[model samples]
Target: MVRAPCCEKMGLKKGPWTPEEDKILISHIQKYGHSNWRALPKQAGLLRCGKSCRLRWINYLRPDIKRGNFTEEEEKTIIKLHEMLGNRWSAIAAKLPGRTDNEIKNVWHTHLKKKIKQKQDSNNQQLYVTVPKCDDLSVIDLSESDNSIIPALPGLIGSPGHSPMSPQPSSSDLSTVTETSGATAETDNIKVEKMDSSDMFFPLLDQDLWSEAELAENSSMELASDSMVAAGFYSNFPRIDDDNDMDFWYNLFVKAGDIEELL
Candidate 1:
C-alpha cells in the first residue's frame, strides 16, 4: 500500500500555524516570492502543506481580504444563487465580493437549511378558522352593504390582478366563490386580516400557527373591538373580530417596506 506523506517528510506544518509561523511565511514570500507553493513551504521554514499555506494566505491572510458576516439580503441572494446552482460554492463565492467558497458552503448548509425547514413547516400549518358543524350552514350573516356582494371571501378576491373569485373570468362571475358543491371546487379560500399595529415588525406566519383556515374566520368586528394584545393568536387568539376586518391591501405595502431596507 502507498503510504501518505508525513508532515515531517513533506516539510509541512504538523499543527495550526501561529503568529510566528505567519511572520515566517510572510517574510519568506516577500523576499523570494511564491511562484511555486509546493517548493516554497520547506524553503520558507514552514511545516504546512504548500496547498494549505496557499489557501490560508489567499482566503484569510491576504492583504486585500475582507472578513465579516454577510447581510440579510446577501444571505437571501446566496440562497437564490445556490438554488439555481447547487453546490457550486466557488461560483457563489465569486458573486460575493469578499466571501470565500468554504464560508458560503457552511452558511448554505447551516443557515439556508434552517430557513427552508421553517418555510416548509409554515406551509404545513392550517390558516383558516374552521366553522364548526353546529354553526348554521344555511347562510352566513351579511351587512346591508355586503348583502348584495358575495358571501365568501375567496369568491371576492385573489392574488393581485388575477381573479381567483371569478366564476369564468366574467364581471358577474367575479363575486361568487361561495357557490359551492360544483364540479370544480378550488383550494381553500381563506382570508386572514392581520391587525398588526406595529409598523416595522411582524413575525413570519406559517400554516402551522396561522393556517389558511384560521385566517378565513377573521371578521372585521374582531379588528374593531380590539387592536392591541400581548398574547399569541394560536393559544385560542389575541383578540376577536366579529365581522369585517381591516383591508389586507396595505399588508403588501408593509411587507415591502420591511424588505426595502435590506436592499
Candidate 2:
C-alpha cells in the first residue's frame, strides 16, 4: 500500500478542504493540538503535506487568527513596518496581533500599491490648484510639509530621518501640523478620546495650531450662550491626548500650510 502519505486515508485533510475539512481540521487540531504536522495527517485524517498543513493551520485555520481585509490604518502600519523591517514579512507580522505576514505582504502588493497610484493622481490635481507654479513660495512656507503628496509612505521609514520635507530627527517625528487658532470654546464637560496607533504625526494637532479666528471658523457649534473665545482653551496644546493623533494633525496642518512651522 502507498502508506497514503500518512493520514491520507485516516480522514486526513486533502486537497482544498470542504466545509467538512474545515470543521474536521479545526476540531481535530483543537482537541489533539497539532504538535506534528507530518504526523497530524495520519492522526487527523488529513491528506495535506506537513508544510501545506502547517500553512493552512497558521495562515488560515488558526483559531485566534484575525480574518478580514486590512483597514486603512493597518495598511499604514504595514507600510511603516515594511520600511523598518524591509521584506521581513514574518518579522513584520509578529508585531501585529492576529495578522499574518502573508496577508500583510499581499495587501502591500495589491491594495497599497494601487492606493498610492490613486493618491498621485489626486496630488497632481491638487498641486495645480493649491499652489500655482509662480516660482515663489507661499508665506505659510509649506515647502517642508508637502511630503504627504507622495503616495507611498514606506520611504519615510527606511530612509532614516529622511522625509521629502526634512532630514532632521524632529521632522521625522513631528511632521507639520500648523493650525491657526480662532475661537476655542470652554466646556467643563470636555471629551477626550485616546488616539489610535495609526496617528503617526501628532505633536502638531493641538488647537494652538489654529489662530483664534481660524478656530472660530472651524468650531462645530457655539459652546457658550455668549459665544466668547475661551481663555487658554486652545493654548494647552500637545494635549497628549494621543501621540498618534498629534502626529496625524501635524502632517495635515503642514500639508495645507494652514500653520507653517513644518515649513
Best-matching candidate per TM-score:
1
Candidate 1 lDDT over residue span 111-212, tens digit each: 876775554233223222222222232333222222122123433343344321112244432221233444243333223221112311223343255443
lDDT of 2 by residue, 84-134 (tens): 456788998998889998988888788865764554444333222221122
State TM-scores per candidate.
Answer: 0.46, 0.44
Candidate 2 lDDT (Cα, 0 to 1) = 0.47
Model 1 CA lDDT for position 207: 27
TM-score, cand. 1 vs. native? 0.46
Indicate which candidate wins on lDDT: 1
